[model samples]
Target: MIRKANLQLLIDREYGIGKHGAKAEFARRLGKQADYISRCLYPAEKKGGKNVGEDFAREIEREFSLPVYAMDQQRLGSDTAKTIDVEGLPAPLAQKIAGYRQVVEVPRYDVAGSMGPGTEPPEMNMVVENMSLDANWVRNNLTYTKIDNLKLISGRGDSMAPTIRSGDAVLVDSGINTVEDDAIYFFLMRGKLQIKRIQRGLDGLTIISDNGQYPPIEVPGEREEDITVLAQIIYWWTGRSF
Candidate 1:
C-alpha cells in the first residue's frame, strides 16, 4: 500500500519552509493542481479528501525519473542474482538498465525500526540517502529471501544491545514478513515497532531480547495475529567508520 504520508514527505523534501507557494510549487512539479494536492493531504474528516492511490505514486516516480516502483519500496537494492529483463526498452536504454544488474543503489531512510521498548514507525518510505553496492557483494554477504527488498534503516533502544546497539543501522528484507527461522525480526506488535529475535515454536513465536535485563514477550499461536512481521533483520552495523 502506498502511504499518503510518503507523498507528503516527498513534497516536504522538495519544498519545505522558505519555499514560497510550497503547495503550488509541489503541484506544478507533479503536474497536478494545487487544489488536488490539498485534497490528497487534507484531513480525513474533510469532504472530498481522498487518499492518493497507486497510480499517483507511479506518476510521482515518472515525473521524478525514479526507478519503476521506487515509491512503493520500503527499502532499496539487493542482489537477487537473478536476471533482470530489459527486453522492451529502447536499444540504448535497455543497455543502460542491463548494466544495473551488476550494481544497485540502496536507500537509507531517516526512520528507525525500534529495537525494543518501541517508538512509532514511519508510515512512509522516505529516502534520505542512498548507497551503491555490487550485486555480487550483496548476494554473498546478506542473507535475504527477496531481491530489491533490502533497505537500510536506523535502530534505537538497547533491548537488543551488543547484538544491535543504539544508533546502529540494519539492512532489513522488507519482503520477508514471517518467522521463517529463529532469527532476528523487525516487526510491529500492538501498534508499536520492535526489532528482536523471534523464536518460532509449534505453539507460536517468542519475541526475545539479547539483553538479559529485558524479559521475553510471547505471542502464543492464538495471539499471533497481534504481531505484524514487517521484515527480517538480515544485517546490521554500528553506523560508524568501521
Candidate 2:
C-alpha cells in the first residue's frame, strides 16, 4: 500500500500540472487513447491501482518511462522487489490484490405506509466496493454502525509508541468522532493520514501524542489550516503475536 502511494505521488510529481497532472498521468498510464485524461474529475471512475497488484505498476513503467515496482508490505522499508515480467502478470492477481467486494446486509425500512410493530428486517444487499487498502475505507464508505468497516492500520512512526508500539496495529473507528481526552486517532493533515490524539485547548485543537517526548500539535486559529479531523480512534489493538 505504501509503495503504491509512493508510486502515485512519484507519478503525480512528474506529469501532474497544478495537481491535475496525476489525473492526466493516470489516464496515460492506463492507456487511454482518447483525450479523456483532461476531463472533469467527477466521473466516479475508480482509477489507479495499489501494491500486491503488479500489473498497474508495469503499466506505469511503460507510460511514464520510469521503473515502477511493488515492495513487500511486511518489509516495506527494504529494497526487496518481487519482480514479475510485464508480460507474465496474470489479470486475476490484479483483481485479487485490488481487494474483495462483499455485500453488506442492510435492513430495508418502510416509508410508503404506516409504521408497524412487527417489522421484518429485510436484508438489503449493499455492495462495498473493493478499495486499495483498508485505510481507503475511511474515505470511501459511509458508516452505519459504531464499528462499520473499521480497520486496524499498523503504526508506522514512533510518535505513538508504548501504548501503540511501532508495527502494532491500532483499531480505528470510521463512524463517529468520539474524540475523547487521550485516545489516538487517524488524522488527516496536509493530505497525509497520521495517528494523534485530540486535546481541546482554550483557543484551538491541539493534536496530543502519547509519547510526551514530542510536543503537542496545536492548531491555533492562525494554524487552523494545519489540522483537520478525518476520524477518531475508538479502540487500539496492540501486542499481537503475529
Candidate 3:
C-alpha cells in the first residue's frame, strides 16, 4: 500500500484540513499539486528516480513554503509489514483462523478383503481397492510456530509482477483490515482467489494490477459473484538471482 500518500491523508484528516488546505493550497500556489505531495510521500512511479531525492525537497522548501525532511528508514516502504492489528474483528473468526498453519491432508490407499474357507473361497475380485484418509496431517504439513492468522500462499499470475511475482510466496493476514486504496489482498470470488490492490469506487471496490498490462477489475459489476476477502497480504518473500 502507498504509505506516504496515506500518511499525508492522515495528516490532513487529523488537522481537519482535508485534502485542500493550507499545505495543499500553498503547494498548489507553488505549482505543486496534491499528487506532487502524494508522490513525494511515496515515489514509486515518479520521474527522476524515487522520492525526488534532495533536489525535489529543496524545490518544495523554496517554493511551497513547506519543510522537507530527509527520507528516513521509517518513511520508506509500505506499512503492511510494519504493523497489522485490526480492531472490531469478530473474536470467533479471529480464533478460527489463528494458528491454522497446518496443511490439511487427504490420504489415498488400496484395501484388500478376502474370505477363505474349506470351500473354494469366492474370488476376492477387487472387492475394495481404494480408501482414503487424512494421515499425519498435523505433524507433517503445516507450521504452527507463529500465533498469527496470516499464512503464505504462492502467487500465480504476472498481474502483480515485480511487486508480487509468480511462484512467489505472499503472506495473507485475515486479521488485517481492508482499506480503500492500493493494498494487496487475497480476495475471493466464487471460491477463486485474486491478489490485487483494493480501489474504492462509486459503487463498490476496484481490483488493480501493478503491471498495467491487465486492466483494473471492478467487483460486482464485471462479476456478479459475491466478493469475500480471504485475507490481506502483509508481506511477500521473493528470491534474488546470484
Candidate with maximal lDDT: 1
Clash count, candidate 3: 1
Residue-level lDDT tens digits of model 2 in 34-107: 24433322133545422324665465556656543432232232234343443545788865554433222222
CA lDDT for candidate 3: 0.48
- Candidate numbers, best lDDT first, in rank order: 1, 3, 2
Q: Which portions of model 2 miss their true places by more than 4 Å?
A: 1-145, 177-182, 240-242
- lDDT of each residue in 124-230, candidate 1, tens digit only: 86999986555666666667766688888888998898789888868888899888688998888878888899999988888899999999988889999898998
> Which candidate number maximizes TM-score?
1
Q: What is the RMSD, in Å, between candidate 1 and the native fold over all Cα?
A: 15.0
* Structural similarity to truth (TM-score) of each candidate: 0.58, 0.37, 0.37
List candidate 3 stretches off by more than 4 Å.
1-147, 177-181, 220-225
lDDT preference between candidates 1 and 2, better one: 1
The per-prediction tally of clashing pairs is 0, 2, 1
Write one digit per residue (lDDT tens) for candidate 3, span 1-242: 33344345434433332223535764565576765655555556646433545565455445524334422223222222233343566887666555343223222112111111111212332322221111232233333323245354556667777677766655455565554455777665554556777776767777777777877767754453476665677655565444
lDDT at position 14, candidate 3: 31
